[model samples]
Target chain A: MSATSPSRSEQVPLAESAPREARESAAPAWRRSPPRWHGVAEALIKTTALVAIVAIVLIFVFIAAETLPLFTSHEVRAEVTPSTMAWKQTWGEAAARWSWQPASEIPKYSIAPLIIGSLKITVVAVLVGAPLGILAAIFTSQVAPRWLREILKPTIELLAGIPSVVIGVFALLVMATWTHRLFGLEHRLNAVVAGCALSLTIIPLVFTLAEDALSSVPKSFADASLALGASKMHTVLHVMVPAALPGIAAGVVLGFGRALGETMIVVMASGNAALVSWSLGVSTRTITATIAQEMAEVVHGSPHYVVLFALGAVLLLFAFATNVLAMRIVESFRRKRGGS
Target chain B: MATIEPSQRSPGGEPRAAVLTAAPSPKLEVRGLDVFYRGEKGGETHALQDVTVDVFPREVLALIGPSGCGKSTFLRVLNRMNDTIPGARVAGKVLLEGEDILAKDYDVVTLRRRVGMVFQRPQPFPKSIFDNVAYGLRAHGLADKREITRRVEQALGRAALWDEVKDRLDAAALGLSGGQAQRLCIARALAVEPEVLLLDEPTSAPDPIATAKLEELIAELKADLTIVIVTHSMQQAARVSQRTAFFYMGRLIEVGATKQMFTRPRETRTEDYITGRFG
Candidate 1:
């Protein structure tokens, strides 16, 4: 460093004696002026974000507007009132009051069977998906070798890249026969098969979110645990898992919402039966499936069309609620961490 | 080396018969330890080069050095914590009571239990204060609730933290002040009843008052437990340790009694560093 200083000093006067114009021209032109595209890029990104938020709000407004006729229009109300949809109707003494035969002569519209079916399939999906995803995430983040994790993480996430329709077709054709042979189910396509297939879709979503959370836990925490003589398994299970609980919970809630609103998978594999039975082997139809199956064929302004929109409105509200709840949980957990 | 009388060393501390003998057998005998880390540039960075030190029983041995001088690395060598780093390589022997802890088949879990560590930053588990102290006990299969509670209180008391945190044992450990949290970490390590405790710049994160409190705790703790502390502060080494080791560029420059090393350091580099000539 010292040896170069004399040579550097010897050249300073010669370089500085050059004209100011020459020095100015020597530097690159782009370095002298700010690029014009930077501001435009920022504005584009901001507008895109704003447009996304506004579009979501607009969609909810449109769906809610469509459901408004159920309360206001007499023609739509004659077939399905909010009260009639929720409560038992007197179709006949023999006919089931809590049925959903929308195309029958009486066109019964009790949503109980659809609600029960949605709950049953969603519950099954969450039960199967949450643990599998969480455990897989734990393995990838905490236990798996680096090479194995490199292979496993992308492969598991590849499940998400597969179109839900393809998964539905697989369930409808291949899984239907497998379930019938393995469990001897009464229906070849039942709630269990559809729920299991639905779980396959959520596993990747939950695993990605959960693995990110687990990986983000500070290394210091693990160091402290291990330095206390705790085994690797004990350190991960006790310390890392609890630290990442909020994120894991958010993943599970998002998976639940996805299962609730999923259309193609449930529609193709659930046998389209609106049964209120608690049996997993029986066929069922979720509200999402109901809307998807009926929306195209129904008359645009008919009671059935409005009823389907109302179910859509309900599904939309649930998705919104689940998102808000997950956000709240994550926010509260972050605040707690920051405060402590 | 000057041999101070045992009575003058620590008035009411643990017996120095094991430490003050003519040729004292080291509680931790590290011989020619070398650590190499694989750098991002695909080169082997020699972190510690042919370093050897002896930590006698019931003594506070302070390792003082500048940043990246291998003091912290030497401390981690006691418990084999360097094994966690992916590209870290260790050579030479770290013998604990004549048994080579660097052996291929050495059980790191057992080694860590016998030689506990407190990090530079206080990292309490995301658990209640009581649970933080009880983590090791439970990990090692001490299942009785009353026994855990009793041991937790005892360990906290040893760390000089029980009186402050006793009433709110259920409160999150992270809620404590930096000093209290560090003491809580000490308590957590103490709960395991390790013979040697390794502190790697433990006072660097806390405030001056906290540093003083920790220094005082070290004085009290050395009554029974052997301590190896790595610190950047020369004054802290002079105050808290019985013997001080000065390290520079991953080499042990000097090791002697704190009084002698600080007042009349034999090595020019050690004297220059202590006098703030260069880090």
Candidate 2:
């Protein structure tokens, strides 16, 4: 009946055909309409991504604005200051306080002590960790057989997942106690203990990134170098390592940023007394530890709160600068890959 | 259209070659040489089977074969390059100047220095053109700045690239065109001044114009250095080499004057391959 109606004598007019086709398409659409709740995920996901990105930016802006008050040069006080606040008189007055100091009249935020402490700890950590990480990477990527590589790589990477607070507690109880016994006449919050604990944190990052870089060296370069009568060790040292240098350097910077930002490890293992000295046995403070130790107690609208945020600013700038430098190194290496 | 003609063979050449077998002075020799690469973790794939050949001083010997027929493998074995691959094995004797190369006491470094190889592709170091040529010299302990400069120039001249590169020695060698890059590789190899220069399809990556230049360089190099080249082109083999060895499935089926091999080959495979038959 349907075939005879439209086939032999006359074709359907556009008015009739259009509605028929629209109904046919809509028939299937209605079947899927019942699941609109599940389909809501598409718009929700996009909106969530937008919200998350905006939230992160806002947090960064808030941190920067709150911290700006600490720079007396930028402002007499932070723009969001309480109406009842008094002007800080002198840098000496701010710095001379035993407890948390306010931003000084001349901005004598003697971060010099904290800076020195941070550097001493970081230098020691890099000294112990960089070579260890690079050598482990070389062994895993170049010398160790596949079976050993498969076993060791995951085991080493698993160290990265271990919480810093747990590591800090171990460093505090075990490492600090052990040092107190081994070395006489020492404060427990020594930079060395914290540095060692932090080194453990960085080693996983360095080993993973360095090995990836080393392994990424083309096999052909190694072959050619070996064919030229160079030994495997020589090939790796002269060719592979040199070729993968930027990536390794990036790994080291990333590890440094991580160690610098590490709070719990430094707060617990490092003697939290904010004294400026080079002695490994004496207690010291890193920026992260200072902020963490005082963050909750500081009044929300007070200069104390803004100062901790300023400490965060210092850490953020340090990390951002390092990341930019590492990225530049990688860029230069890529440019060299126009490789004649 | 052409026929075999021994351009350099004297009447008593076979007698001389036979009598000189135990002599202390052949540039390079391989006796019953075979190289095998393990296909799997433990599986073996024969890359080259029993092979025997000699390279006389100041001679260019062409190694010709289809792809994967072990021509390059034979070249690598000449310098113990097969030893680099895991589970890759070699059996037989390679001798440089009557000194057994595979002998445990022999220094592979000295052998490689004296038997340099130019690979299929140009591999200039990431440094300047000057550094690329200076690499071997520096490795071999000729590290003085002045001596390195002089030697780099001499090697580049020998490679016929000095005139073009002399003014820009500080520029990276990677900027060179394919032909120039190949020549830079040759210069790098020659910086060590090996007695026998091994060219492993060195011109394959270059255009014809570069290839013609390379052919000229080869002709010039063989004047004082022995050369062993592997090529897929029958005409190139005939054009640049005095003698040729034909390899098939890892075996050297025929070794004779290049002219004679292409014209009246002893093996049917050689004839078929030269005449464009299935290799």
Candidate 3:
């Protein structure tokens, strides 16, 4: 290189010229030039994103301000009144009990059963959805033929656009009867039914994401494995699968979040019996279902309405946590790749 | 070489395996090998045609030609990597260890294992150095964990990388210097223990020093493994290979011992190519 080129110091100065160019480009904005409409348009293209974020923050501030009064004024509880049925007035009241019911002019709030029911359905949904969806992704990415994969992928993703109410209807009419007949389930709107219906929604989400992850795996790794005399399946199982773990985890978490927030399917199919039972065949209710069912009946400014908002807060926190965890997993994977 | 999966029936819907042998009957034998692509224009475009060559064991054969000469395409035929290409077809025969690789009765998985390939770029797995070396072993289930660890050490040592990376086995492979990454790739191939290693311009992506180091490593590897190196750089072929074959317009112009082919040419095209004339 020295024989055919200038001295290394000359090259160093040439490199230094780059930083000088950067400085030249960094002059103060006002002195550079007055902006035109197109320039403003271009800047708007970038700032549109910033504006959207500010909009979101404004909405969040509004929600927080409106919701703050309830938390500050009173511990959430049912107000005893001259009535015939029991009902919980606030989420804080509901949260403090193991079971909730509004009966015969008396309103009592207990949300433990609803919380437990939500946990049951989400757990069941995740357990069934994650593995099946990931496995679908693995087969599509690693094993399926190119033409078949192209056709199958979009068809699977089409599930995402299906109306949630249709899925619920399908679950309620067809699947519920099948479950009751096959397994002799006592409750048609059981956790099992909700989980299966939710799994349908979850599959497409996880598959698209997980397939992308698996597809991004370097071909060299596959070649190296195959050259090692490993069977194609073996290669997929041992190398490709593990390498795509972060992506698979991301897909699963995203799927879980969608399932947790799902309302129509759970509302219609889940028995809405706040009774918490570990058996999948038994009746259950998710937080989403509880909110959906009670939202209409609760007075607009009542503590019960505020309690529902609190539930919304809880659900949002869960979804946010899942997304953050997935981001961390992906970030760690990228960092490891970078360090290597 | 690592042992091939014991021949077993694939559950319906998968292509059957092709038998691969690495006893070095002709390190590679080709007769009337042709590749064609069905273009969107609905016409067939031949990539390689009527190609024929016999590579001897323990010898380095270089394929040099103009761009799109199908030199790399023919090189990939050694392991049937072309099989992955859609609408790409290989007619005629490629014989390894006196067996017909194109025959439907053959096992492709087993065949690929016998004929390993290194791509033009050094693409290491997104894994730690130790895991990268261990990947082949684990994927094939060729050995237990204890044994795999041993082979990882041995393969890295053979690639001359153990010293630099011994203390940092857990370092990601992507972090390695260019030379190290290429060697790591070579180590991965070595871990697989293929009898034949097909390299498609192994050092093309590296610096001069790294390229030289790779040349040295190839010299060492050729002592034990049959190497078919495809290089566009004539200097590289002159320095590293035992035999040289020039390819032009998807055809093999000549094949002879490297020194004789370079110094004493039989084909005019080969002579022109080596002397820096039109391909």
Instruction: List TM-score per model, in order.
Output: 0.89, 0.82, 0.84
Provide the lowest-lDDT 10-residue window in model 2 chain B. B1-10
lDDT of 3 by residue, B51-159 (tens): 7666667778788888898999998778877766667887877778768888878887777767878887777777788888887677665668788888889999888
Best by lDDT: 1
Clashing pairs in model 2? A189-A270, A189-A271, A340-B174
Quality class of the docking in candidate 3, CAPRI style:
acceptable
RMSD of each: 7.2, 9.2, 8.4
The number of clashing residue pairs in each candidate reads: 0, 3, 24
User: Which candidate, 1 or 2, has the higher DockQ?
Assistant: 1
DockQ of every candidate: 0.47, 0.23, 0.40
The deviation in Å at residue B88 for candidate 3 is 1.8
lDDT of 3 at A30: 60
Q: After best superposition, candidate 2 residue A59: deviation in angstroms?
A: 3.2
> What is each predicted model's overall lDDT from 0 to 1?
0.88, 0.78, 0.77
Evaluated at residue A207, the lDDT of candidate 1 is 99
Model 3 stretches astray by more than 4 angstroms: A1-37, A74-97, A102-104, A336-340, B1-25
Instruction: Please give, for residues B157-264, the per-residue lDDT of candidate 2 as tens digits.
Output: 999999999898988777888889889988988888888888899888638989999999999888899999999888899999988888988888888877788788
Q: What DockQ results for candidate 2?
A: 0.23
Q: Candidate 2 lDDT, tens digit per residue, A1-340? A: 8877664234344435567676455343445444777768888999999999999899889998886665553343543232212222233434442222443333324465676678778877777787889999999998898799999999999989999989989998898788778876377768888888889889999999999999987776666665565666777787789778888998898888888888888988887766657887787788888887778776785666776787677778888898998899888876664451
- Clashes in predicted model 3: 24
Could you tell me the fnat of model 3? 0.61
